[model samples]
Target: MSPIVVPSRLKLFGLVILILFLCFPYGGAAYSPHMASVVRISQIYSGGGNASSPYGCDFVELFNSSSVAV
Candidate 1:
């Protein structure tokens, strides 16, 4: 059986991809604490201002998912 050979263009493309991946910044497991989303939209009431709804205005409720005070 003959040996399998790879093309030079494919090898060059693979090397370029590797270099680009190594040169650019990627987001990993380590992230800043301030970058976390502490507050989130807990509830959204779009049925407001209707006849069956109790509230007369549409509102969005926000809740803090973290333990820190806002």
Candidate 2:
């Protein structure tokens, strides 16, 4: 019968580290546009802002698929 060689704890740990490095390949503090979202002009008004206007300036309304506001 052939002998089976079980890896030592330290060797196993190193193997796990190598596997992680190989799988991830790189690291960084990064963001994805897909995870976030893109905002689009939902509405627009032609009138200039006045004292009567609540929003101030010629305002534009933006919208996105996400419920969370930016």
**TM-scores of all candidate predictions against the true structure:** 0.43, 0.34
| Candidate 1 wrong stretches, greater than 4 Å | 1-36
Residue-level lDDT tens digits of model 2 in 1-70: 9998776997889999999888877674477776455677889976667777766668688778677566
RMSD of 1: 7.9
Residue pairs that clash (backbone atoms under 3 angstroms), model 2:
none
Q: How high is the lDDT of residue 19 in model 2?
A: 90
User: Candidate 1, residues 1-70: lDDT per residue as tens digits?
Assistant: 9998999999999999888888775833576577468878889998889999999999999988778887
Best by TM-score: 1
Candidate 2 regions exceeding 4 Å error are 1-7, 28-30, 37-70
TM-score of candidate 2 relative to the true fold: 0.34
